[model samples]
Structure formats: C-alpha cells, structure tokens
Target: MSKAKKVIFVIVEGPTDEDALSSVLKQIFSSAEVHFHVIHGDITTEDAITANNAKSYVAKRIAAEMKKYAYKESDILQIVHLIDTDGAFIPDNLVKTRTEKGIQYFEDHIETGEVKYIQERNQKKSSVVASLCSTGKMKSSIPYSIYYFSRNMEHVLHNVATELTDDQKVELADAFADRYEENPMDFVAFIESEEVAVPGGYTQTWTFIREGTNSLNRHSNLRILFEQENLKSTD
Candidate 1:
C-alpha cells in the first residue's frame, strides 16, 4: 500500500468555521489529508492565555489533536490556523460606547456598552495573536502559519448580515461549501477578489491589518494560503 498521506490540520474556533471551508480545503489539498479541528472557542480571548504562554498553549492543543487523531508527528505536514480579527488590533479611541449591551462592529469603529471589556479582551487577544503571528514554526519544528478574516469569518465568506444565529451560521457555511464543492478551487478566486483580498505577501499583509481600522473592515489574508500551495490567485 502507498504511504499514508500527511495531515494538514486547519485549526478554527467552532463548527461553523469548519463547515465553511473544510470541504474546499479537502479538495484543494487533495494530496494530503485536510483536517478541520475545531477548538470550540477563541483561545486568544481566554482568561489564561497571554503572549508569554501562547505558543506553548497552542503546541499543547496541537499535541492533543495529534493524539485524538492518532497521527504521529511524522504524519503531519503543516498547521494552518484561521482566526477572526474581531477588531482586536484597533486602537482604544475607535471603540465607541453604546447604551444597549449589544456589540456592534462597524467598518471603522465598534459600538458596545462594554468598552472596558472589549479593551481588555483586545489587550489580551491581540498580544496572543501577535505572538502567534510572529513565529514561523511551532516549537515542535512543524511549519505553521495563521490567517485572518477581519471582523469575523462569516463576513468574509459572503454573508453580509451583521448578526447571525448559530443555525444561520451553519446554513451559510454549508451553502458556501456547496456553492464551490463542484469546483472548490473557485473558492480561492472568490476570496481573492478585489474587495475581499488583502494585498501583500504573508508578513506584509499582517502588517497591513494592524494599521488604522482595516482590521474592522471586511478583508482577509487567506490568499497567502493559495500562494503557499503554489496556486496563484488572480491579481
């Protein structure tokens, strides 16, 4: 029998995230096993996570995934992490206050009753995210990279409505997967379209998001994934 295909683990926060891109990723990385591992919540914003321990935390998560899947380190190809920006990198002044408790994310500002809460979350989340971004490989020597969809994954995946129920999120993801299931490569084209694509190489693109309110707008640096796979996205 042929050797088992190496695993390409795509880490995400929840099922909707996995549902949205798992099919297309499997298609795109046909030579490998494309696995979507949902961690159930944003680890970046967790109370214990900080820049100091973020990598070790993620490394443990990856180890756990390997155990759960029965995959050896030798059986791993790479790790690709997909995260929502959630306006985490925006400056303090851009976060506007609100009467109601709901959080409303706009193109250039966020409206929320918990300004201090968001600010604290941002301080914690951004540092952890930035810590992850600064590294090219995990301590285990596995090739790793993180990509982002600003505001949230749903926003970049063609669903424009600001608020969605979990059921609605799943529906959108399934629909998106089906829309490109026949020609999953087309997903690259959609994400790389003029309006959604963040223009730059890997590091430069990350730099771009940290500037001004770009992180709150609808944008993504996922085109870099296609580029890594030697697939050119339309300019």
Candidate 2:
C-alpha cells in the first residue's frame, strides 16, 4: 500500500507571499503535500479581518476549508502563517508578556531608523496554535507557526536586487517562479548561494534564504517557521 500523504497548510497574506513561499516550500517538502491559501489582504486587512484578529480569522478559514474537504485534524500536519511586518505593530501587552516569559524576541533597527519587532519562534507557535484550537469548533489539534517578512514582500524582493526597479523586481519574482516550476531543488540551491543579497544597512532577508555567519543570521521569520515544520515532519 502507498504511504499516506502528509498535508501542510499555509495561510499567506497575499498572492506574492503565497507564490514565493509555494515555490520554495514545494522543494522543501517534496515528499509531502503543501497547500497555500491566500488571505486576500495584507497583514492589516482582508475584508473585515485585521492583524490583531488574524489568528481567529485564519482558524475560522481553516475550519471551513477542512469541512469543505472533509479532512480530519490529523490529516493536517501543520498550519503556517506568513505576513509582512510593515506597519503591523506588536501589541504592548503581548510584548510585555513575552518579555516576562523570558522569550528571546528582538528588535531590528532598519536603515530608515525604524525598529522591526520579531516575536520568538516558540511564542509565535504556541500562541497561534492556542488561538486555533481555542475556538473549540475544529475537530482535531493542528500545530501552527507564524512568520513575518521584515517590511513587506516587495521589500524582500528588492533586497534580492537593490538596483532593480519595482517592475524589474516583479519580473525577478516571475523568473523565480518559472525556475522553481522547472526545478525546485535547483531553485533552492540558487537561493542558498551568494547570488542573493540584501542591500547593505538593510534588514537581511536573504539570510533566511542562505545560511551565513552574518549578524542577521537566523533572522528570517519564514526560515524559522519552515525549519520548525521540517523538523516536526522528521519526528
């Protein structure tokens, strides 16, 4: 008998995030099933949903999708959420709580002199899972992980090519999609190479793609989420 396929669900803020992540994750989870569902909004808004309510919004959506597909909770090995950190302020209460809990959250000072908040991986995972299962409307317990781009999707692509115009960045993303479709592993290898680089003095988004000894190492939220999920699958 064929082995059962493990399903992993990703909830992204918009098409760009979905597209970029789908390309990378397809390679990362080659043996398993990965699904990307767009929330049709930025971190702040998608119809009536806001960043503060994203957890609830995603949980309801997950429940609905599960019902539609008749998938039990066990069928879903994990649920990952990707959102841009632009203008999405971390609640003070949350910050205080996490700090008190001794979570290792950090503040990244960007070139624009703005501070970007990164929530600890453990905190984000536990909080998201709690929010999802807390509804009590879903049938099974599903693990959850949340990640955020430093500023926005466009910013990340721009980091890959600081000299590129907005139009050029879009083209680059499309090229990445094409390359990914043709050979996912090769695409990952390309990302892992030094060919991808963020502009000096900017938040190092490329560090998520490539492991290096830079000060920004392991700072990529998506990288953390993906690595955690990968580890879980192995266990």
Best by TM-score: 1
Q: Which candidate is the best by lDDT?
A: 1
For model 2, how does the per-residue alpha-carbon lDDT over 22-107 read when each residue is reduced to its tens digit?
A: 76676678666787877776434434544356566667788888777666777777777665543223332233322232233333
Residue 188, candidate 2: alpha-carbon lDDT: 47
How close is every model to the real structure, measured as TM-score? 0.94, 0.56
Candidate 1 runs further than 4 Å off: 1-3, 159-161, 229-235
lDDT of 1 by residue, 1-235 (tens): 2237877889999998988788888887887888788989998998888899988999899989888778887677788999999988899988889999789998889889999999888888888988999877875677899999987999888757387889989899999889987798688898888878999898898998888988898889998888775222211
18 Cα displacement, candidate 2 (Å): 2.6
